[model samples]
Target: MQLFPKTTTFTLFCAFLTLIHAYDVVREYSGVSFFDEWDFFGSWDNLTLGDVYWLDKSDAFSQGLAYVNSVGNAIIKVDNMHSVQSPQKRNSVRITTKDSYAVGSLWIFDLVHIPYGCSVWPAVWSLGGSTWPEGGEIDIMEAINLMPSNQMALHTTSGCFHNYTPPNQLGATLVTDCSTAAGCTVGELQPNSYGSGFAAMGGGVFATQFDVAGIFTWFWSRPNIPSSVTQSNSTSGIDISQWGPPSASYLAAGQCNITEFFTPQQLILDITLCGNWAGLPEVYFPSCGNRGPTGICYNDNVVGDGSNYNDAYFEIPYVRAYTTGGVAPTPTATPFEIVSKVDISTYPGYGSVTIPLSAVTATNTKLQPSQMFFPGNGASQRISWLQIGVGWWMTSIGVIILIELL
Candidate 1:
């Protein structure tokens, strides 16, 4: 039975405080990171203990349309022709240091849906909790509107840079031949012929794994295999070790690309309105009155603070942290008092208790989406989660607590 070890009640009951340094509250701060806005204040308000994740979106930009039940595999629908003062202000849910992230941690952001067009910019990036880029920024997903699928990249100083390209620019198309690459326009990367079969199956899955070693690997999956990506890269399949530059599988095999660049980084998620990437010369430039002879995307569909942009949001099923086991290192005592030890003292222990999701709020209001209970020694008796601590949140607590992102 896995009891949190007990000491015989023979000597003095000295009390040591368990380093309860972790506080679970997801919210945005007032400061802005390098590549974006300042007026917007993003946050994770309703958060619970378990895999507490829900979607927060703005219907104003999306025309109030949502992608669910796999219809059209269209999770996002942004208008490239639209222009805005701050791309960062449009539809961005910031995942900041307040969310508990740091070096030696991994963050996995999974997305599946429409990933291209003009002026549409979707990204998963990070900023330093203390400094700006010096704290490090990792961009897991940065797909300029127009490409069929997505692009993986990193942003850091020269001394700390971490970036990767899809095996080929045809990243998502390699899994599904959705790109009409042949009909590609001026700034757009893929042919107009492609939309990746996002409609056929459910949306696809895009994930990033940041390791303690400071390596970041990004990959994607579509409803069907994308021919566009395969045409761009050398390998294609359910297993995409040969796909990204620093493939996680490749690293397992003793090779590296991501680790070579940035060793430690924070993961961020944001959908900007119009900025560097979305406002590229070849991209949303046409709508800005910068047109070529043919005049495609030159109509200027959007003017100021564009309306009716696609509502792109993420439905996170779970976020977990794990470690590949190694030799046992020297054990340090965890300072947690035995308020009431788990009743493992009984072989077939007492039954478990269920905690109300609402009862576990730590100011963020994140409810419990999943449950965790440990039954000891095949014991009949069990215990559900027990509350060890509670309190209002502090700003300093946002740092130091490592968010286990995998």
Candidate 2:
């Protein structure tokens, strides 16, 4: 006998399809509450060998290296007041999201300012793994010294390449190989995409969408931001397709398998001085000329009085993460309360402790931390099917299989 009347079976099938179609896209991170969602990178040893020291939570806020401005914006900055002798790194701030995100999501950064100055290397990027190049690094927004425009890049293992270009991309592809050292880089064509020019335009929004199809990045100045993005909040969702042409695009259709090369990425924001990239003579001399008394990146900009770093601070209003298929839980205003610290001393350079999810007391909020990769840890965080927003589709498939057996 049939499992049920034909009409009943048809109704069940339709309900399953409806559930699959009812996925709601929502913001995973909201503006102004960024400090509550992110954590201070406690490592003092600069991984990039930058001429700066990374501050822990207590020191960052106590020293005023990181704090929320009176205007309700988050400010993570370098010490622009104190002078230090040679061989000593300046105090700086580096922070990352407590949660790591896999693909199939869009990340939007709304900013009023970005760190800049000679010897300054600031980036708003994402890292997939702890090991360099293997986990993949997405440079959503990065530039060195007094760069006139922004640079976007993807640093991955061998085999990934940017052979195909998306239509109407505004940036120029500077590199084709998506390998470690020379990551596939794209230079933004807009002069106002970085530095003083960007700040003059009242800063803007930089959006990066990682999907099965490709990785795309777009930039919109304050006055030109799309209504769809500006109006989106934690409860509401954003429509990236309606945002128009992206500034940069890296297609993964044939050239690379994004799923294989990219891991669950954690968002990172930091400003380092005279690092490997910014300190190189080839990079520093061309733009900044011979600077300071010693005519060196570290001696000139990083040493002596920190007068050169007046602009070296990130003033962000909010950063939002959106994913399709699942309804976003409403975020509570409850501040992140650290109940305990996890000693991650085993991880080299990350000898300090961090507030893990289990240490958080807020159980009713969605802003709680997720599985993450501690500093220097090489293991990749696996993304589950539910995290991919395919739970409904999986249920639908199970129903079909059950009906076949019946």
Candidate 3:
């Protein structure tokens, strides 16, 4: 017969800790649900965009710039009514999430199309405060005019900059100092990475992970998306660890203190016309100069020359946030003691017991998760059983002593 039946039972107990450890989907925004979760910004236009035909905030639905479509997708588009002769302000939409998120979370964006064209500036970025870059801004995706590649940027107060290392998987670093008004940027080199090129390639996925280490962003254009990310639902496991190399990585290990520079930020999606970046005649003409009259493109030409606003929009499939189960803390060090060397030769009878000094010292022990298992259905009951199991082991240790004595 086994000396300790309880000990054997405890050792074989199996625990299914799927819920407590797995990353939970904190929030999901899509279709009509997306409209409900996000708040429409109806205030006067602010980005200093000279060419935009700002729509009335009160008549957003009537203007056809913001609404849920018959297919149940959240539709935010620009008005096609404006033309060069009329030069009427074209209707556009801007919206932000009602909720905010902090560091140590993963954000995923599945887009069907994003804005592109002359004098068109579209962006999906995150911000913390109204006083500009003080609270910091993370420009997840932003571009001006018909740029081929996606641009990712970070804007913050002085002293925050990138600690660049070789082999950046996404794009080349354009600016390292984040405090500049223009912000630090990393530009992607792929032809199909952004704008019309992105649409032609069947859109894609953009994911960002934020933690103590820093922030990392990844892109998977349609067919190339990982199954784990694409197939994940409420119950299915979504392991960020398996997503592979990131396109852009900002490490706070040496230079930036992420927590100090960033704060609880809300997601913003908007498309503006001929604002600060795209307004300059000299800068705007390079990409779209040939298209405009007399080989010239200007801010007013966006509306005056009459470019169709239909293509200047964003079609997002969904946006999701996952609460990361952070790295577990290191276990406490095992108890131990140090003893002075014993002069056994000085002892009379005890001199024969020549035990090595190291042997008597306590062995450092590390308790692995597998060592303790509670075979129960619910968490509360399992916890109760765990306490009982621990008590049983203590009893088993005592019984072992008793057996030795006998």
Maximum-TM-score candidate: 2
Runs in model 1 lying further than 4 Å from the true structure: 1-92, 102-104, 114-116, 161-201, 212-214, 222-266, 286-308, 311-406
On lDDT, the candidate that comes out on top is: 2
Q: Which structure is stronger by lDDT: 2 or 3?
A: 2
RMSD of each: 20.9, 12.6, 20.7
Cα error of candidate 2 at position 359, Å: 31
TM-score of each: 0.41, 0.76, 0.72
What's the residue-level lDDT of 7 in candidate 2?
77
lDDT of 3 by residue, 1-406 (tens): 4454655544433111222223546678876777776666654345444444444445667877777667655667766655554344556777777666666566788888887877777778876655456567788887777766677777777888875733544455667777765666766544566777689988898877666577777777787788878888644546664465666667776767888998766777877766556655555666666765655444335545344666877787788876544331111222122122222222121101111122212111110011111122377346646645654675566556445434
Clashing pairs in 2: none
Q: lDDT (CA) for every model shown?
A: 0.30, 0.70, 0.61
Which segments of model 2 are wrong by more than 4 Å?
1-32, 326-369, 372-406
Summarize candidate 2's per-residue lDDT along 1-406 as a digit string, tens digits.
5766767777777655444323234335444566876777765433566888878879999999988888878899999889899788899988878777766667889989999989888889987755556667788998878667787888787899987766567677767778746478777765577789789999999988776667888888788898887886656655544466677778887887888898778788988887767777766766665676665788778888898899999998888775544322111122222222222222111101111212213221122336632211344313333434466565756577457546
